[model samples]
Target chain A: MKAIFNKKITFVIIGLLGMVLAVTVSGCKVNEAISSKTGAQLWGENCRRCHNAPDPNTFSPEQWKTVGMHMQTRALITNVERDKIVAFLQQ
Target chain B: MKQYITIITIALLTSTFAKAQTKDTIEVQKIGDKYYVIVDHPKVDTTKQFAPAPAPPPTISKTFDSHFMVVGLATIGFLNTWSVNKVNTPTGVVSTKLPTTNSFGDVAHYEFSPMFLWRHSDNILVEFEPSFSNGSLGVNWADITYFAYPGVILRAGYIVLPFGTYNKRLAAGWICKLPTDPVSITSSPVGSDWGIELEGGQQTGKMKVNYDVALTNGFTLSATDGSIANPDVNAVDNNLGKTVTGRFGWLPALNSGVEIGASGLWGKAGDANTAYKNVSTAMGALDFQWVYAKKPVAINIKAEADMQYVTNASYSNPNPPTVSDTTYTYKNLSYGYYGMFSIRPIVADKFFRNVEFAVRYSSYQSPKGSAFENRQDQISAGVCYWINWRTVFKIGYENLITTNPDNNELAITNLKNTQNILYVQFSVQF
Candidate 1:
């Protein structure tokens, strides 16, 4: 009985993974164009999807440089884009 | 007689001469720090004037006086600059329902925490986070951190122990899709301690590396059973040797949507007593996080596992071969693991874009040696609505199961083998 229960849980997890993958693939097919917007606008549009948006002026210029570069990798943005975002936050 | 007549004539003449002289415009005037006589009745030119040399612009010598002003200005500059950290407010309510022989419902918990941060400069920051629950107030974590250089930071004061991603990343309600914390962390582990640490992370090549090393007040055994080791959060170190904790991780870049880490803590668990000397405790954990956000779908996955081991424990046995001798050695150990998955189906529709669905599964077991077999498993599923970027409303349903078959006597009547819980929370950070 315990083995059967474990098998059922495994199936449920697999099914959920399949469903998530299907949805993600369909979403990518629908919206193929990459966004070409300002750093501030991109940050608001992207970061807000998962967590709350942080204030731009929360860190200093020096701090923003480091944070922005780190976030670029975390957010999967290009270095140029990270630079623009850092500039916006710094101002 | 001759002198008197002459004096009378001379007085009349003197009066006439004085009046004439006055009409001629003889005048004494002060100019350029000197007195000048001017006769301007077409008899003298007053263009010639005396003037004192202009003093050099007030100058300070290259002595202490000149450098003192420079030092004073610099000191003021340091004091005047400051930064304010983002305010994080996570307040929520949790309710649980037990449907056993003694069926009842209870509002299990309500808590509020406000995070305060003062950034004295780009390199220096101070944080104070206080929590309130059921009219009881407590300090969560308060610390001061200094950024010595890029990828290096030194921190001191009460700090949140860096065990896994849960304590730092998903701790805030607004940052998590579900409103409940994983049972594995809360069941048998330390969350925070008063400590000093060095921590920092940076990208190296295509990977990111982060590390934290700390020394803190260690753990102590439960006074009653000596089985459960508890963190010395609100107390001074009871032993001479301090606890040392550290975590190190290598990630495929933070933006690569994946991160993995390993953390460990070890220290003596006994107080300054000869009998309890050499008693020790050790804890270790592995954690991972993956987030993917794209066109039509967004998914976030997290997992963690923790194991705890305690040295020899002496417990009084209820049933012993020798009735007079009741003390027995028990191997104290426990392990727990949990996984959480959340996804947002970006269906181009306005409503679905702002909604997320998530699920979590957790298991914890502390095998029976003393009293009863304690095994717990929980399943939680929830939905979140993004009011904006920083505010979220979440509701989740949690089903928990436990087994304890030794005795009927329990702390709470409603706490039994099975329980269903409903949790709702509204969180915002700015």
Candidate 2:
């Protein structure tokens, strides 16, 4: 019974580590996709002159939520564009 | 087999009851014509999420600050030490050595000097100078200076003494260029006593305008008991009298590829006596300097001429009562002009170091009625190695030639005038 309990604990630890690794890898992919799209849009509109394309991974999701408000003043992105950007970053 | 089937049936029933209890609860009751029911379940959606925003950028502002004074003080201290140690030998030696030292040395015997200066702001600066040499006590050289603006500065303190154009040796070069008769007995260290001076100046671009006016209360030339009187001429009582002097100069550009400037000074020495006829003398001089250089390498040329006129000089002897009063005059006295061309080249870039090679020529006619009236000239060549902005080491060789008067009126006849000098100097600003 004690040996069975020890095996259970080892399985739980491995599972937790696997979950963390999966989240980190997915976060990086999502950040890369978001940054590429943002860069393309910014370059197309000549917005790069004033501000560089935002790197999603540079700030956490909570920080990005507030930054989105300030970006709207002159960024002039539609709701659909904003939603797409967020979705890409959160992927 | 029957027992096993019964146990399985019981376990299945128990599990079914537990499942029904854990399921969402709902109640229904039949009324006259309709049915009413109550239900319970988890309330809201659990999938939604939110994130926080980023912080704002920082700001910048402006304010005044102080610079470190330690470095400046250290520099000043080093220069004082260097000047004192370099000139110690000459201050003690009475050798018939050639005037290998600069003209400034001939003018006033300089002892070791330590000077401290502080500039609290752009508008205020003060300085203190004390000198010691030849077993003599330290003396105050200068102490006061005030600035009203970048272009104008006011000074009130012990000013540099001015007597003959050749006086104030510090202002002169390290060595006299002219050869002198070995036999003539001339006064050594020819500066006048200290006095008050007022000076104002303006500088712009490469040009500078300066004016100085000075007055001496009185100074004893020598003590009756043979002591090295203080450079502060007013240290003794009998040597009290007012001296008036003025100097002006204009330099268009100091660091330009080529630079030129001319300076002039006029001064008067009041009576040496109180009741009897006071010895009054007036002296004037003009100097021109030119330099050609490009940053690290340059050549400098300087030339100056001085003249003096004396009046109301008198002497009395107790043996003669009927001899009433008589006056003596010495006029048209002139000191020959000297010129030097110095070549300086940067020797080290790391420390802003340089090496200087200079050749000088000086000639002056002795005062009339003073035993030695003949003229003399000397030539000197020296090299100076600048260790840094505030330190230098110098070595020089000088040759002297004198023209003796046929009348033999002076103390000594023909003499050899030549000497070698090695000196090192360090200066700092604090």
TM-score for each predicted model, relative to the true structure: 0.65, 0.48
Compared with the true structure, all predictions reach lDDT values of 0.62, 0.40
DockQ of 1: 0.06
Model 1 chain B poorest 10 in a row by lDDT: B68-77
Question: After superposition, which runs of candidate 2 have C-alpha atoms over 4 Å from their true positions?
Answer: A1-91, B1-111, B120-122, B161-195, B203-207, B218-241, B253-278, B316-336, B346-353, B372-376, B401-430
- Indicate the DockQ of the complex predicted as candidate 2: 0.01
Q: Model 2, residue B18: displacement in angstroms?
A: 72
Lowest summed lDDT across 10 adjacent residues in model 2 chain B is found at: B76-85
Docking class of 2: incorrect
Clashes of 1: 5
| TM-score on 0 to 1 scale for chain A of candidate 1 | 0.54
- Write candidate 1's Cα lDDT for B1-430 as tens digits: 9999999999999999997777687679765456877766555555654355446557653211111000000000000111121212245322343333211112223445665555565456666767764356777778877767545667899887777667765656677677667778778667778889876654444444566667888777664466655554568777887777766655563243577777777777777775666677777789887777777898888899998776665766555557676666655778899999998887878788889899999998774453534778889898898876556777778787775444322221122345566666666653
Supply candidate 2's per-residue lDDT for B47. 25
Count clashes in each candidate, considering only residues at least 3 apart in sequence or on different chains: 5, 37
State, as a TM-score between 0 and 1, how close model 1 is to the true structure. 0.65
Model 1's CAPRI class? incorrect
